[model samples]
Target: MNLYPINAGNFKLDGGAMFGVVPKSLWQRTNPADANNMIDIAARCLLIEYGNRLILIDTGMGDKQSDKFFGYYYLWGNDTIDKSLKKYGFHRHDITDVFMTHLHFDHCGGSIQWNKDRTGYEPAFKNARFWSNKDHWKWATQPNKREKASFLKENILPMEESGQLNFTGLPELDVLKNSALGFDIFFANGHTDKQMIPMINYNGKTICFMADLLPTAGHLPIPFVMGYDTRPLLTLDEKEKFLQMAVNNNYYLFLEHDAHNEIITVKNTEKGVRLQEVFNCNEVFNLI
Candidate 1:
């Protein structure tokens, strides 16, 4: 199996919102903000080449939203899924599985796109089976008021409408041993309901798609939760357990939202689980 970091693009999010209750004095050290107080963010999607299946995890937000809508999140990079795939000598049509970590627009928006002629939407990966768990599918489709905006209909419904959507079934547990994607899945609900984190074993090491469970190296502090989380207290607990496990196993965390830090490892310090080392994508994955 081969792994590639498919950078969808870079954008900005409010530093305050990204770091939750943590004061800027702390967060700014790792994620400095612009004059407008927005911090750099990346939609660093992951692509896996496993035998005959090319799997993509968590597509960045697509370009279909209006300029006015995108004005909120200041976009800042030239990277796109098409461009990223081309870099690795692949294409969207080559993807056999599009596994979503969650249904938030930024995480799954690129799964669907405006069809030819722009009359309506359709699955972007014509040959891919879009993957989302049953609980998350239901929660995203019938989203709560707090998360309604993040779960955009245009970014989601078309996968099902196009008959490419598939639900992954796993028994109730914190970790599902061998999921439909041929990797273990860590179920996290603190950020969003039933968000799946993939634990991929490659070359005698484990690479975890950290998603929002551990967004960046700066989020190592247990209390450093996002304002977007539905239940901050629940996030605190989930993070504590997850970080401890990460430190114990020495998993290579492949960050999806951290613009600067592509991957990191954690160590149990006197304070708590702290950033052990930071690595670029090429250093860890040996890009195709």
Candidate 2:
């Protein structure tokens, strides 16, 4: 199997929100904020090439949202989903599966696009089955007041309408969970309800799509939880446990939001679990 780092683009998010209660004095050293207090974030996605299947993990914020809506995030970058796919000699139609980590706009917006005449929404990957959990599908469709803003209907609703929506819901052990996509789903609830983190076993190593669990290397510290999470304390517990397992197993974390650091390893430090090393995706690929 071959994996490609797809650059869906970049955007800005509030530094304080990204770092939660962590003091600016600490996080700013790694991820500096702009005058508006926004830090650059990459909408990185993963492209998996296996036999007769090309699975894409998460679609970055699409260009369908209104200018006013997008202005809030301050989107910027030279790379795009289309350009990245072309780099690997493929197109949207070539994608057989779109494994969404969650229904957040930045992660799944590019799955759908504006229809002809720009009057309605349509599936961007016409032939791809958009994969999301049944529980997350329900939660996002009936979003809460807190997360309502992030669950844009335009980014969703199109997959089911296109008849390409599927689920890997709460799989039972000993079963080939994501046999369709060729990965095991690690469900975590601290970030959002039943958010699926794909654990891809490639060339004797496990490359975990970190999603929002460990947004960046800077967020390796247990206390660096995102303020947007509904349960911050739950996140702390999850991070502590996950980080320990990652450190012990030498799993390569594929960061989704970090602009600079793409992949990192964890190590046990005197303070706690800390980032052991930082490297680009190719560095891990070379190890493979």
- Residue 94's lDDT within candidate 1 is 96
**Number of the top candidate by TM-score?**
1
In candidate 2, the residue pairs with backbone N, CA or C atoms under 3 Å apart (3 or more residues apart, or in different chains) clash, namely none
Q: What would the per-residue lDDT of candidate 1 be over residues 63-135, giving only the tens digit for each residue? A: 8999998899999979999999999899999999999999999999989889899999988899999999999
Model 2: residues with Cα > 4 Å off, grouped in runs:
171-179, 286-288
Backbone clashes under 3 angstroms, per model = 0, 0
Which regions of candidate 1 deviate over 4 angstroms?
none
Residues 122-234, candidate 2: write the lDDT tens digits.
99999899999788999999999989988998888989988999988586631236555778877777888778888899999889899999888889889999998978898
The total number of steric clashes, by the backbone 3 Å criterion, in model 1 comes to 0
Residue-level error in angstroms, candidate 2, position 232: 1.2
lDDT of each: 0.92, 0.89
Q: TM per model?
A: 0.98, 0.96
**Root-mean-square deviation of Cα positions for candidate 1 versus the true structure, in angstroms:** 0.9
lDDT of 1: 0.92
lDDT of 1 at 243: 83
